[model samples]
Target chain A: MEIEIERNLVMPGDVVPCPTGSMPGYGTYQNEVGEIVSNVMGYPAMYNRLVCVNSLRGCYIGETGNVVIGRISQVGNKRWKVDIGASQEAALQLSSIDLPTGEHRIRSEEDQLHMREYFNHNDLLSAEVQSKSQEGKAINLQTRSSKFGKLKNGMLVVVSPNLVARMRQHFCQLNNEVDIIFGRNGWIWVYYNNTNELEVPLIRRQQIVRISCLLKLMNKALVMISPEKIQQVFERTSDIELEDLLAESTLERIKDIDAVE
Target chain B: MTEEILFYGFRQDGRRPGELRQIKIKLGVVDNSSGSALFQIGHTSVLAFIHGPKQTKHEKESGHIHCYFNTAYFSSSGERRKFSKGDKKSNEFEANVRTMFESVVLMENNPHSDIDIHVLVLADDGSVECAAINAITLSLIHAGVPLKDFLVSCSSGFYSGMPLIDLTYSESTSFQVISEYRVAVLGKSLQIAYLNYDDIGGHKLTPEVVREITAMAIEGCKQVHFIMKQELQNACSN
Candidate 1:
């Protein structure tokens, strides 16, 4: 878009070149003299009367109801501390998760003892941010939804959080071969669609690996990833061998692809 | 007033009293880290990076910062010597860096987070502290950390009855240059974030000398800021 070309770039602490009357918005703060200043390195754009800085890169800060994928780092008393690519570990309380039978029951001491059976250390899982503590220190996440739970037999591809654009649906099924979850926290998971199979089929596994590699390439080039962009890339690189796609020469070519188009 | 310190109004290295050395910088050098920068001024090279806003042992109201500053064995201009972390001078410099950035960084924005800072002085001609500060500031910007303004620094020395800006290793350690001032200022605001005065020869601390040297150092900071701004713009364009 022409508008993107005009977006004024600002580094941390730079004064936004906006009008004096504009209100400070996300990634920006008003100084004592009342001028809007950027708090991060990025372009400053106006959302109505509020001037906000669209940061190009930073740690993930999840809001309420946002779906995120994280690794369980610590199994504590009745809670699992998840490293969700945020500044702090997100808390997955025992009460926030549903049992396998989908029954809502009060947590007994037995459940606390069996917490490891549910989610152990270093286990990756998907959950929704439920709420935050008053100080915003403790991030509470819930895995009550049917699709939100432990992830196994999958490949995880991590990109910068900013590269994944917010979409109406983050989950996509590609050609009935693989399932992709574009976690808002930049953790992309490509797993087999068939849950019953303990081992992934060779074809599906190849597709999963290819998809993850493409995602990494897009992220390295600072391109925003969306379902449409993924389809285009799959079409473009279909002929190249999967191992050769990540070569330095191919990466250079891919970086300049937009210009050729 | 030593004749050898400055030969006919030009220093040994052939730089004017007001001139700074050539600076080269590259951002995001350490891809694994959240943010990293390699900053070189003259022969002084420092690599600075930050990791976290991640897990911490204890919780706090705002982001907690930890700084690690070290110098390589071959960093010094003279005979190579290991500048271990326990060295008094390096320890003091680390504390000064952390305290200076505490106010500049908007820590409250990332409450209950831990920010780790690591800086290694690969080569030290002079003004290693100033170089470290500038490197950290650039990497912080690369990481998109919140800050009131860019924290830039410069070292100035009072010698030969004149103020010398951006001192080199020989100029800084010369017996004739009795006192040196290292100042870090906030970009645009022109406020001093850090001021370090070293009296190597037991020189008396005078108000006039302080004012003059700090003024020269602040001017140096502005020049440093100009160069850093250009680097940032180039990174964005790419």
Candidate 2:
């Protein structure tokens, strides 16, 4: 049988019980006295033999195989520098990306010359972390899949990356005909489900706005976000006006709702 | 000698010789920065903002920490004094603060990144550098930056055959005090990170006197660490 432990908030230097043979994980270190201690401000959890603390808030740290949405800040000679809200800009090298032709062939020098034609500065796109550089100084990104490409006709909302839990699918479409791409790096894109339509219907627009407001509220309250919680918040606030959802009283009510859960 | 700062074995603020001033801390006060904190130690107040662990334009550097310390004209009680953009005193203070944090913050975690700390003095009564260190610690915690331990600092002054902890500006500058020292301690191990002393009126301190003063300052630092821990826990809960 596995022993269960309650989540408790911990600060730096707080001693944590590591038991006899337990191992310390991230956000924790072993002291000279053989006691496990936390190195950051967060909640402590015990997973079998491993104990680690989940940081409450902080800048996003990217890892390989994660899908992230970022803006192109610079176009280098053969790579485009993308800001994925991490410490370092991820590099989308010319060799990594699939050309517009979608052909798997050797790249010519001419292809490197026209790297700008593929992605311009300030353009937003979704990509996957391919690998880390040899020195671990920079991240390498790839955009070869159909889903990973330039984001168009969408509104971006940024939040703390910690709030976004890893999920099987970061893309979701609500029943109200609003599509959302929850970037692992804390950037969320909301748009109408019907991309072919030039003008989004009033109801779809209102739903998108409602989702945006919900995201903002969760961020402000510093609550862990999930698809179920977002849906519940959206449904609960359906009676209230979209603009009024941001009112202080409504925000307070939402906080109470979250606490009860 | 007529106006004695120590009256009936208590200081002018009615604190004991080894007592510290009231300390208050608030976290995440600023929205734009990655992390921010407002810290107050008695009349002295410091607002700290931390940005990044972000990419630096220049390459080849593992990680960089930059700090800027600024004092407002109206922070002091006396006549307002203007400071030029390149004030030497403020520049030196900023450099000292930056070096202190570079040792405390775990720069090895984020290689090739930059962490910038901006500290603004809203009020100056005394011990501004100590207050700045406390504020920076809170802001770094708020930003979720990894660190070996919290760095708590306190100042002590030897005067009238007694050691005073957490001295105010008036007490430090007063002719009654002979030597003053500021000490920063790592919270977990209680190891001294930085220490500096100055003779206020050319009154040098002996080895025994220096030891006594340092002990008092370390005690003050422990008290400060207690308060910081409580404040950080509160911030985490809410």
Candidate 3:
């Protein structure tokens, strides 16, 4: 089926054109006269019978089943509060994580006493959103699988969540010997595998910085991010010096490249 | 005084009875704020910043809005004077602006959250309340907060048996003017959100005069709404 795409720039209080039986989504409201009006300054996108406006800039709105990286802000009796850069801190319950010993036993008071040993305040971890509260004020997070756990020996880069595209595989090991974790919440982790060896090559460190600079540039330009685009930009900028990648001329060049696509 | 206040059908600024001052709005002027905007109406200027939609610490309500109105010591007429935090006039203005916004913004959508609006007057030529309202509206738009409609405000006064629209500070405070009123309305629905008389004790306004002044104020608000809508669209397109 061929779907027709209609995009229009709209501002607050502007009456949007909606056909009968069409439903208004986010950034839109129906007035008393039954006309759909925009409630934000953004681009209105139409999909079949549904219309929604995508704002130019906004805070991250979390969703269920999305992998996110967060810092532990508070350790409570049975739950830990994680700051994922959302409107509200997410709750990570003691019952949601698996012990390091790989035991499936029930959580006890003794386990609560040892919660600090597993995770301390300000410790970073990756987990999936399990559920949201009835009022949508709080999110429940779970990290039962091995892939979701505490992060160690990594540098985190924060960007707008809108830049990060949701994908199946957010974790990748680049050919340059650096591992990257692209958190759906727009926090990226770059680190070397210290478990295998303590010393990382100087070339690997340069590549990591290059990738980070590229990501920052793309975010500044508000380009939709994807793994392919990152790899392509990295390949195209290989001729530029590492320190010069963030210069005004280089950023302008990157923006031009993004515009072309 | 009457002849000087109204010259041939024009106000002191050479504007017609219904003409408004030039309005300029720029969004995202303050990079550190979640959202900020600088709004200028003729010589009057105000900068507004919005921070939040985050977790509320004390209030258990679904959504809470806090507003602060401040004027620089040099913003007023004549010599500079130190301002106290407990100044009654500033506090009253803050409370009024906060209540007006709380009515238009869709607070129920953001439960357990608070939105703070801080407005600073950079210049005060006339109609500071109206300028502050416009600045806050643009700032909220930059923040991407959901709203029912754009709340636009304007000031008008009855002078020389005619209603003058978008009055300047001089025109509003002139002894020849009978009454001056500030009005705010929601653009989409044209619903009145706020209305107040700057000075009502000196003269008793007839029903017909009150009705005419209100109609003129609403007209001025509509004009402001058009300019604000255009500016918001310009911000999004580029």
Off by over 4 Å in 1: A1-6, A133-137, A201-206, A257-261, B1-3, B60-62, B199-206
The DockQ scores of all candidates, in the order shown, are 0.68, 0.70, 0.54
Per-residue error for A24 in candidate 3, Å, reads 3.7
Task: Give the count of colliding residue pairs in each prediction.
Answer: 0, 1, 1
Error of 2 at B132 (Å): 0.3
Looking at model 2 chain A, report the run of 10 residues with the lowest lDDT sum: A252-261
The DockQ-derived docking category for candidate 2 is medium
| Per-model TM values vs. the true structure | 0.92, 0.91, 0.87
Task: Report how large a share of the reference interface contacts model 1 reproduces.
Answer: 0.78
Q: Is candidate 1 or candidate 2 better by DockQ?
A: 2
Model 3 gets an lDDT of: 0.82
Each prediction's interface RMSD? 1.3, 1.5, 1.5
| Cα distance off (Å), candidate 3, residue B114 | 1.5
Encode model 1's per-residue lDDT on B1-238: one tens digit a residue: 2547677788878988889999999998998999999999999999999997776776554567889988888788978885568788878988887788888888877767778899999998989889999999999988878888899999998876778898888777777785568999999889988888776667775788778888999999999999999998887788
Candidate 2 ranges beyond 4 A from true positions: A1-6, A20-24, A30-36, A46-51, A132-137, A198-207, A239-244, A259-261, B1-3
Which wins on lDDT, candidate 1 or candidate 2? Answer: 1
lDDT of each residue in B96-164, candidate 3, tens digit only: 887888888878767777889999988888888889998999899888888778999999999768898
Candidate number 3, chain A TM-score: 0.89
